[model samples]
Target: MPRLMLTDEHWSKLRTILLEDRVYDKPEHRQTMEGILYRMRVGCPWQDLPDTFGLWNTIFRRFLLWTRKGILQRLFKKLISEPDFEWIFIDGSIVKAHQHSAGASSKYDEAIGKSKGGNTSKIHLAVDSYGLPIEFTITGGQPHDSKAAKPLIDMLPYANYIIADKGYDSEAIREQVRGRNSIPNIPRKSNSKVGNDDIDWCLYKYRHLVENTFEKLKKYRAIATRYDKLKANYESMVALACIMCWLPM
Candidate 1:
């Protein structure tokens, strides 16, 4: 399938902003930075990054630094102001951590040791029905889906509808979502419901967009196999992946 491409104006704006933040310190820095962005945009591996990207190690290090500083997240927020946002979808997925990415001190709340996947990290992401990601939260594989739902949900305000899975069916969550004037579209758990609640199966089918969003995100090899020793870096890559998904054709 053909991939989406960034426009000249988009490139110019990104180059200007990223360069201001010391992204253009070296002759090869611009190329390296663009290379990594291209790799993220195309879901390619670092080693496989085309020769045009210059030294992969340099690009990777800069990416790590940007990740630590939360640059990618800020960049995504700036870039997504043009998206359609009447409805949002929330969901979570697990990314198996490569052994190399292991040894991160268990001190990291988002760094959970092996459970079902043997050293895997979990990602909770919220996206629009168009599969444009809004926000993400990283945690250990063992963390309950409900654990990060609150924080992830809090990132978005004034959403018309917030859709989630049955796992998020809780009185507290429902009440909290109500505060934003957004109704929860999640089906009530079989054991938890008292009476009939309207659920539109047709609209419910839209939840698959979030699922497909996860599917496309894992296409990045580094993302599919978590290698960032820091949770922030891993999550930054998730944001970069989201940017790729939101790229205009």
Candidate 2:
């Protein structure tokens, strides 16, 4: 069998969340889940999955059903029910969109846009103080970070502070963060009239935690580059990666 990413203990916790309906046998579902993780980690086409994990098509179909049902997002939500809300860090990162990721027929935006890097997608992420992901949204690469900031901030659980880089520096964003009852720790641009002296440089240093979270997530090749034609599929891939981060905690 291929090396499994989740241990028995980790799988035990996740199994409760993923297979709550019990449509498939525990062992079979576990194997198929491993198969899905294998594809996500290695960034391979479904057909390349090895026989040890069973038929590749079966795994792919199962993944599609779960994505449609929002099962992966639910799993991530369950894992993070009681997050460390003392400090929430928000940031956005751009991922190069592979040629294969294009060609969606749906009217909905696929979160893919043509930029200098060709086609690209942006992942807007919010992580807790410990550098663990709390929530995220995908957008076209051309969307400004501040553009996605409000929605991402609105979805966060109660937090005392929200931190981000200067790219997200804007009065409207600061107002949105304040509306959530959280102080915005974003640094202002040098050209801005506001002075930096009032900003908490000490707490601002922890802003790296969100960047580090992005680094860890990008370690999964599937997340480092977009390959799913539909935004829903890409969102599911991201939710699964976030769940993996919470598994060992």
Candidate 3:
């Protein structure tokens, strides 16, 4: 079996999530497991993986299986619970995708179109006041930021407040926030002729934390480059990025 380079806590967490009861008797299974840990840490593409990690294709397949089975979500939820946050911030970042990632014609093919740059993928992330990630949603580059607003907001339980930009200033979203018994701290656009931007100025100041969280997430080379060819793998990279954030500095 390949070496486990993650910290003791992370390794233990991975072990619990993986549940050793599941067999890893085959060489491919062991390799793939190591390959995932390697990709998460090194943020490298499968094709660029080193030979000692075993077959890249098998690793990629295992990643897909884990993602489809809600393993990633379970891991993310566990990490999210570790943080104590009174408020959460929401934002999205576009990642430029290489042409190779566009070949897949799956139902979640949101990374195929052009955005701020060329073909790209949008990662909508929600983070708590301390920049700890709470939720993540993926959409095509062309998808509107507001399109993900309600879903991301809906994922959270009741909170003190939720902060977002003017893009999320829809009456529907405001209603959704109120429905959850949380204050919608989103500000209205300056151009909005309907209502005033009534968000508390002080609370809005902390919105930058989520922005910084996106900056940190993009620091990973794999995340900065969209090399995962598949949405699930790419999203796993995001989860790994969040996991790194949750760990002690």
Candidate 4:
């Protein structure tokens, strides 16, 4: 038997969500989900998935339907109905895209862009105090952090602090965070007249929690490197990985 990624407990929780979403009622639901996980864990082409999980084309079709309907990300957002909001961290990570990631039909270039690192995409992510994902946005590799920071800052519930790095040290972001009743704990750039004197070094250090979340999610090679030609599909894979992270909680 091939090794499986989801534990019994993980399947139990996920199955409930899938049922509530009314995606499928077949007995093979567990195998189907496992098939997708297997593809992600091994970072293999969909055609190359092992047979123990059933025909890979069938599983890929199911996954396609889920992404088309936004079920994957909807499930992720559902899991965060309650979270520790003492400190909210927002950051972006660049994921290298395979040459195959290009050539989507979208006029917007499908969130893929050419950066200094060559073809790439960026995941603008926010995590809660405990380093669990809260919400995220996908953008071309070169969009500035502040460009994505507004919606994320506006999404969180009122918290003691919303933290980020110097890259997010714009006045507009600070004002927006304060508008949501949370203090911005970002550090100033080196040349700024308003230095980081008021910054809480203790809390700022914890921004690693967001980086840690990225580290954990990237363990799935499919996530570490972009393979899906469509941005929506790639984002679904990332959402599934985030769900896996929440499963252990």
Best by lDDT: 2
Sorted on TM-score, highest at the top, how do the candidates line up? 2, 4, 1, 3
Model 2: residues with Cα > 4 Å off, grouped in runs: 21-26
**Model 3: runs farther than 4 Å from truth?**
1-5, 20-34, 40-44, 105-111, 194-197
- Candidate 2 lands at a TM-score of 0.96
lDDT of each: 0.75, 0.89, 0.74, 0.88
* Top TM-score hit: 2
In the range 75-143, model 4's lDDT, one tens digit per residue, is: 887766568999999999989998878888776558888877798888888999899998887887888
TM-score of each: 0.84, 0.96, 0.84, 0.95
Distance from true location, Cα of 18 in model 2, Å: 2.5
Ranking by lDDT: 2, 4, 1, 3
Off by over 4 Å in 1: 1-10, 19-27, 37-52, 105-107
Winner on TM-score between 2 and 3 is 2
lDDT of 1 by residue, 107-144 (tens): 74657557855888888988875777878888888877
- Global Cα RMSD, each model: 3.5, 1.3, 3.3, 1.4
